[model samples]
Target: MDLALKKQILQKAQDWFVESIAQNHIKNTEKLIKPTEFKINPFTAVYLANFLTGNSNPESIAKALVYPRVLGTSITTSFGTNIQKFTSEVLSAFGSTTSGIDIEFIDQLDGFKKYCQMKSGPETINKDDVETIAKHFSGVLNLAKTNSLRIAHSDMIVGVLYGDSGDLNAHYKRITSEYHFPVYDLSPELVPFS
Candidate 1:
């Protein structure tokens, strides 16, 4: 990435992270929810039981604080997902095609145009999601193929926003096994998947 673009991305990231956390906190606590009103089991409660210790009162207070915005206000929402998606907007500022790919940028080293499907992290996907991602990447490749655009697989990527090589889950392994391109990790390299 160029310096100006990098700076812009950093600023965007800061805005996404800081502002969204504040927003999530606001949305979650929009009403004064008491501990008594907090629902213990969400429909998938049986599955989530393993993670819970049956410690209610104190823990329920924590749960009640976030019950209003359960899915919308997680770590994934605050950090990488929006930021990665935000790159599409940033890339549009350049004369780049913002289609099929979440991020498209000219490689600073090789001067080749690199394509990416930005993911929050390695843990972001499931078995079905792996196939969906392959289809997404395939759509990009086949689109290029039909137009006679010589886009190399080496230039295509599943960019994970954080974590190291070790943090990569089975879902990521499954992607690499099939696609055989980059599953870039931002912590060690430059990708996000979870």
Candidate 2:
């Protein structure tokens, strides 16, 4: 990602968090134990809608407001779940929506399939976790094969969505090499915050 875009995304995310907190505080001033009854402020609706569609137009905001349930859900503390949803939305732009395994898409032209596991960034992992992940994927693949599913041209892909002080790029490299899977660095254009 370019320095300018990164800064913009960070600023947008921070702004959204700050605004959301303020809105929640104001809404909770009445000491209502059940918060879901109150609708989220309009700004939050626009923020979420923009995050999903990358458009801040009034029509988009109005359309986004139609889904009050999504607006009611608070952002995760670490933003991990939000980033995952953002990545899933991005994949859906390419006509994919199977997120049981992070992302699974079928190429319409060639009948090829791609399976992906997504993470917000790199984190420390022990040997046990690695083995468990491998075993889990093995089971999934085996089940697919047993069910006579189309496994042709299927590639196991790992996508890292962002990085902070940690060397997520290096971690992705290590994971790809160790697992013999391809790594896609989506940090450049995939801005979950914006």
- The segments of candidate 1 whose C-alpha lies over 4 angstroms from its true place after superposition are 1-12, 31-75, 78-81, 85-100, 187-194
Model 2 scores a C-alpha lDDT of: 0.53
User: Could you tell me the TM-score of candidate 2?
Assistant: 0.46
Q: Which 10 consecutive residues of model 1 have the lowest summed lDDT?
A: 87-96
**Among these predicted structures, which one has the highest lDDT?**
1
Measured against the true structure, the TM-scores of the candidates, in listed sequence, are 0.64, 0.46
The alpha-carbon RMSD values of the candidates against the true structure, listed in the order shown, are: 5.6, 14.2
Tens digits of lDDT, candidate 2, 40-150 = 577787797798689878767655654443334332233555555554443341323443356665533455766666665656334564555555566667777899985
For model 2, state the Cα shift of residue 1 in Å.
Answer: 15
Candidate 1: residue 10 lDDT (0-100):
76
lDDT at 110, model 2:
51
Error of 2 at 97 (Å): 9.9
